[model samples]
Target: MRRIRIKLNRIPSLPERRRVGRKIMADLGIKLQMGWNPFTENIAPKAYALMFETLDKFLAVKTKDNRPDTVRGYTSYVKLFKKWLLEHGFDETSYVCSFTESDAIDFMDDRDLAVSARTFNNSILFFRVLFNWMIERKYIKDNPFMAVKRKPKRLTQKIRRLFTPEEFNELIIWLEANNVPYLVMALMCYCCFIRPKELSMLRCRDIDLDNQLIRISASIAKNEKDYTRTIPDSMMKYVRKLDLSNPGHYLFGDHPMYDFSPGTKKASSRRFASYWSYVVRPALGFPKELQFYSLKDTGITNMVNSGVPLTSVQQQADHSSLAITSIYIGKTDRASEALKAVDIID
Candidate 1:
């Protein structure tokens, strides 16, 4: 029997106790045991420690079992969701019981500011995922999201704003003068339809300059699948101009890029996104409807306008399904007025 006495004189708070218990469980061979009261007895201590250790185990399993970047995203979103839940009077154990569709909708309604349906839907998805995880472990009886109705049309609407050629030129020039590595990263989003998370893990070894292709390993992609995408030839010259002397180096190394928050090892997509929200985007005098992802939309639009087939563009964009590719092409078609059509209109 291992017995070490800790004095009640310096007893920590509940959260701190949980932390210390987790550390003890991790460092030593001790396990948590909980009976009643939750503040006394070996059973309660062991159970308390087990709960936290299980969360840690779930976290580790997620790290190795899922894509690295996805794990990071889940951790961030889950942590935020947990904080939001606690603030709203929903305890951790409450998640183990399936939440009603109304419960979720009510939660969204409680937000003082009106959030876009997509944004609100995303939060619902986080809870749905959490509950699904709970169900898988027999923590919950069933999934509640299965019954939630689809969000309204107003909330589901997408704002499609392709950058005008003039705006695109000005945006590029501004970034170049202002020194933002995000400029090149943004160009990659346009040129290749590469997601921001994919770009974050890009390494020197993935580029094949001779073939003008970038191999996005399944390891870093959102879809848990590997794909090789062709880079737009228009971007080739500048890509060649980039310093690739250090093989296997990050394309965007730590530099004096515009408003780069220092000490972050990799450029966070969220932080890069803030640049659009605050700086380079505002300088161009674009409206709120115009978005950063619209660069990818612009690329697709450019392809269709240049007479590239939808199927061909789909392959280049590395979309898994034809339906998704069709949506991209269709959305771009709506902006055809923004592009010049040489079809000889009378």
Candidate 2:
């Protein structure tokens, strides 16, 4: 075996040295002509390194811009992709540039079997962003994900089970008896038609008690649109009773079970969901699917059943269209009775 030696006049920077080494290896036929380097075969492929480096930069920018959810979501998708690759016998040294449309399809197919349609769609979206970024940086000649098509999402009719007035009253009693710190949050969701995540983002300043209104900033809103909703008279009573010494404090400030640092303005929805799953649900005997979101459904349905106009319900629910709000208004025995009453004999 003959070892080829090359001497340079001066040492270059680490990045420059890597480039020089790759070129030298290529000239000697010791490396592949592809984007990957066989000389660094023990280490991960250059494509993987570039992909991860770009991901790191992307996540840093997103975090600095106060988009923590985006950071978390992108990180999750990359991790899932890496895991899928490893499961299919591709290790760390596998060339990410070798990723093809078929590879992406296989990953999606595998994911579809294990997760929901919405989750699979989210995974595809993440890949689209990642590969597009890679293409922009010349990490790859083309975006492989662009060639992959998402599976058609099944049109499953959403059946939102709303809490009856009796059930809601019983839940309130249970919450009070248990001294649940999330009682205010539950009340806001049920009365104001606020999503759990939106409720968690509320601060004292966002609430105008005198005017009986709550403002949801664009950053916190799901649609990224700033909107204000009038507080229900019942909810206003609870707001008045709350301690508002600090106008900047979180509306539902941290509890032992679900809390952030004193200076933190918002709580994590995952933490809130954990509290609901482990503590609240078991105590109330609620089913697994009857989550915190059910409160919002219960509130909107209650209003519509009580004869609130469809347009009013749409505004209250922050739905973009009345068609969306109509889904929440489920049929009731009272509705059946009304139909019977309106029926005329021939």
Candidate 3:
């Protein structure tokens, strides 16, 4: 099997881009035979069709949160995986139940694609989930991904992404100037130190503006336990000004500014990284690697630096283990307090 890396030449203007795209598609044909999947016993065409249809049905019916956009993304990922698998000589007709841990590991290692470890991990996890679902539903007798542990490399880069005072001010000004909502959707996770996924299921009614508190139901929180975080007094005015007439409306409702629908909101986490790249970073002149999750990191850092108790931040951050919070706090000047018996040699 031949491995080819796709290279994008410098992007031309929109008109030029459209012309290039059309020409490329024309050259490739509407549906050309890429490779054959032996599992279907048919040529490439039937196997590819079956793979897509299977993925669509699985995502649409299996996901706990059945948002349209979420399903759409899973469909796209599965398609990309199928393309990769075929090009790499993976059989499609034999149930994925025949696969093993080594197969999975080799697949990741052998790929010429220059993707991140996190992305590779996600692809493996997606396959794991897919196989698990298939096994449970009797589509297959066993799950191939059960013992396939994804041992990802340690994240060496200390995540240094947060809005400085100047950057934050620029973000606000840009939003206001463009009539975008000033409510920092990303900041809710950071300032309150909640998980990004939890923010998605939040409803307008969950917030108590009068009491300056936001309650997250146990059902939606990452820890699966009910917890409430108080909205700081400083942010109350911003909360008060928000329109919350629709009880069913999400806190991050489908605002025109964000171009989000309920479908978009469910898939927001997947899109959050891209949002910062195309919109937030460019508008604020920040680095390309800056992600929305960095907002949470900054929030935790500021809270710790300002002498907030680690225990309190842990609870707010919904960390199951105190050790995790300690890692985030790192070594602090307050370490002296813990070292009561330190002796200095002359």
RMSD of each: 9.4, 6.6, 12.8
- Report the C-alpha lDDT of model 2 over 45-122, residue by residue, as the tens digit: 234333344555666765676566777777777777777877886654344455777887888888878987676677
Worst 10 residues of 2 by lDDT: 42-51
Cα lDDT of model 3 by residue, 1-346, tens digit: 6332222233346775565456544534643455533343322211222344455568768566754546766777777767766776554432233344566566666542556556666767777788676656544554555555565468435445665667666765775455333244554666787665667677778888878778999778665678998787766665665566766776654444455333223435545555666776787778755566767776777777678898888877777777888776633323555457767767
Better of 1 and 3 by TM-score: 1
* TM-score (all chains, Cα) for each model: 0.68, 0.75, 0.61
User: What is the Cα-based lDDT of residue 23 in candidate 3?
Assistant: 51
User: Mind giving the per-residue lDDT tens digits that candidate 1 earns over 92-131?
Assistant: 4332322455655665565424567777677567657765
Candidate ordering by TM-score (highest first): 2, 1, 3
Best by lDDT: 2
lDDT scores in order: 0.65, 0.69, 0.60
Clashes of each: 11, 0, 3
Deviation in angstroms for 340 in model 3?
18
Best by TM-score: 2
Query: What alpha-carbon RMSD in Å does predicted model 1 have with respect to the real structure?
Result: 9.4
